[model samples]
Target: MILLGIVLAGAAVCVAVGIIADNTAPATLTVFGQHVPGVSSEAQVFVAGVIVAIFFVMGLAISSLALGRSMRVRQELRDLREEREESLTALELERQQLQRELARARGNQRPTTADIPVAGHRKRDQDPVSPFFDQSA
Candidate 1:
């Protein structure tokens, strides 16, 4: 809507300027190395207005396409950031679970030989003697 308004305004200004110039001096325009015979200033103004409208429409189209492309890129970046955050959170949880398991394993350790008991012997740390062969024999 704004673009339309701008184009219309530009056309109106061009036509008004053309009318003023035509009222001031009525003359023929010269082209590239050739004279445009019997061409009025009003006709030149009309041509200039058409050219402005064409350029304005083209500019609007290019800008709209650029905006659409930028929007798509922004969305993709947002999605990628979310995925990365989720992955990082999962890795942290897995690391915490592994640390807990390690701690549990360390706490529940095996007992040493001194902690065990032999049959009818309270001195479990000392070597047992054979009854069949005495030390004096």
Candidate 2:
């Protein structure tokens, strides 16, 4: 579309110049020490300008697309890092809980002390009553 506009504008200018110069043959235009053919001047300038503009726009679009992809990847990496940190925190909490349980178990454990049972000294048939005072039997 831009190319079309440039071409139309160039044709209009050329037509005006032709009318002003009485349909003279094309001549060379020299500007800033640069010489381009006077003949076919409008077409040459319009095409070159349009091509440059198109390439510039294309470069901008490609750069934008690359930047967007890079930003998205960075965001994903950040999210993954957060998730990993949360998992590690959960594991640490679970470890602490298990340690507390183990400590409770160890605190509850106590040693028992009891004399050994003698076979011949306190037979059940010798004394049926409370045997605290039965030394004579």
Candidate 3:
């Protein structure tokens, strides 16, 4: 929308300048002390305005392309992040299942607490099972 406004304003300025130039008297223009004829000031001004407008439109187009590319890149990054998160969640679930299976295979006894001591708990060196006891013995 802003680009449209700028283009419209440029066109209006071009038309106004052309109109003013047409109303003014013809002036002699010399280039390198050489007289240049057959070219009106209005025509030159109109051509310059057209060139300016073309440059402005080109700039807007380049900016739009860059903006689109950045948006695409950002979307791709977001998708990748989501995929990583989903895979991580799945792996964590698989790990928990494996741990439960291992504990069941070892026997029904599951430790209620980690090896680390808790507050107000007594530490004992007595073995839960005698070293001489085994199924083969």
Estimate every model's Cα lDDT from 0 to 1.
0.65, 0.60, 0.65
Model 1 lDDT per residue over 27-127, tens place: 54443334445566767745755765676566566666666777989999999999999999999999999888987889956567877775777873365
What is candidate 3's lDDT per residue for 1-137, written digit by digit as tens?
44554565566565445545554444433333444465467677456457656766665666676667779999999999999999999999999999999999989667766666778765555335576764555
Each model's backbone clash number: 0, 2, 0
In model 2, which residue pairs have backbone atoms overlapping below 3 Å? 27-38, 28-38
Compute each candidate's TM-score over C-alphas: 0.44, 0.47, 0.55
The residue-level lDDT of candidate 2 at 93 comes to 100
Alpha-carbon runs more than 4 Å astray in model 2:
1-33, 36-39, 105-137
Highest-TM-score candidate: 3
Please list the residue runs of candidate 1 whose C-alpha ends up more than 4 Å from where it truly belongs after superposition: 1-48, 104-137
> Where is model 3 more than 4 Å wrong at Cα?
1-39, 114-122, 126-137
| Candidate 3 residue pairs in clash (backbone atoms < 3 Å) | none
RMSD, one per candidate, in order: 13.8, 18.8, 9.8
Can you give the lDDT of residue 61 in candidate 3? 68
